[model samples]
Target: MRCPYCGSQDSQVKDSRPAEDGGAIRRRRVCPDCGGRFTTFERVQLRELTVTKKSGKRVPFDRDKLARSVETALRKRPVEAERVERLINGIVRRLEQSGEAEIPSEEIGSMVMEALKGLDDVAYVRFASVYRDFREARDFETVIGELSRPARSAPDDGA
Candidate 1:
């Protein structure tokens, strides 16, 4: 591993363990040159994902960008950082397991909206406003209405 302090290419791993969520491996490393210590989290990549943007441009999927968007929406909210990390991990996992190397940007946005909807109402709306491109106040009201409405129950089995 490279050391961030001295930009040295030689770093020794002192310890290694599973991350808190168990989705990644945490490694404690020390730079021999600067004696600086830092921790790094490593995750297994099932496959490289390419995102098909709305502009017909294909780009490599960025996990950090997605995390930043969610965090921005959840800013000043009651949601915990751990929960947000889990949510982002779940979304990435789903995309990776979907058996598709290229995923649509719209699909990714919808997935984020759905996950945020269940996590926090305020955060959900915050994301929806940007994702859905809410221009007027009615747009916000419409989404809020969807939240206020109750879920439909299953049809009677004629028991």
Candidate 2:
């Protein structure tokens, strides 16, 4: 790795450890030329995935963009930062595991709505408003109504 301090081309790793989140590797290195120490992180890159918009336009899937949308919905909410990070990570992992080169944008929006629905009702409504393109207040009422409904129980058979 190149040293940031002296711009040296050679550096030796002095220590290596797994990052706190276990998502990356942290390495402590020292430049042989200047004896300057620095840290670096390494992470695995998943295969590139494309997002197919409603207009039939294709674009690369962006995690930061996804996070920003979710964060906007969750703004001023009571949800913890860690929980939000986990939620984003979970959604990204699911998309990656689908093993599809291209996925519909609507599918991604639906996934975010589902995740937010469980995280915070207000956030869910906020995200749904934008995702569903709410034309009137009644649209929110409809979604809120759906969220308010009790889950159906399985029908019992004579045992």
Candidate 3:
């Protein structure tokens, strides 16, 4: 590796360790010419994944965009960033594991809604209303009702 201080091409690794997240390798290197020490992070490069829209248009799959949409729906709420990040990571992992190079936009939207639904009801409704394209007030009310209703334990539960 080239040294940033003296632009020396010769460098030796003094120490190697795994990053805190354990996703990459952190290396301590020293330039032979200038004796400058630097740190470098190395990680595996994965193939780029693309998402195919319903209209046959293909675009690169972006996890950050998905997370941003979720964050927007959850704005001003008590939820923290780590929880939202974990939720987004879960959804992204599912998509990546599906082995499909291209995923539909609708599927991604639904996945985000499902993830939010489990995290926060208000956020879920907000995301769902926009995602499902609620055209009337009744649609929103119906979703709210569904969310408000308590879960029935038995098939014979009658109220």
- Please provide, for model 3 over 30-100, each residue's C-alpha lDDT reduced to its tens digit, 9 standing for 90 to 100: 99898899999775435567888878999998776987899989998899886876787677778877888
Residue 2 of model 1, lDDT score: 88
Backbone clashes in model 1, listed as residue pairs? none
TM-score for predicted model 3 compared with the true structure: 0.66
- Residue-level lDDT of model 2, residues 1-159, one tens digit each, is 888999989999999998638877999999999999999978665778899999999999998899999999999999999899889888888898899989999999999988998899999999999999999989989999868865344654645
Put the candidates in TM-score order, highest first. 1, 2, 3
TM-score each candidate: 0.86, 0.73, 0.66
Pitting candidate 1 against candidate 3, the one with the higher lDDT is 1
Q: What are the Cα lDDT values of the candidates?
A: 0.93, 0.89, 0.82
> Highest lDDT: which candidate?
1
Q: Which stretches of candidate 1 lie over 4 Å from their true place?
A: 151-159
Pitting candidate 1 against candidate 3, the one with the higher TM-score is 1
Total backbone collisions, model 3: 0
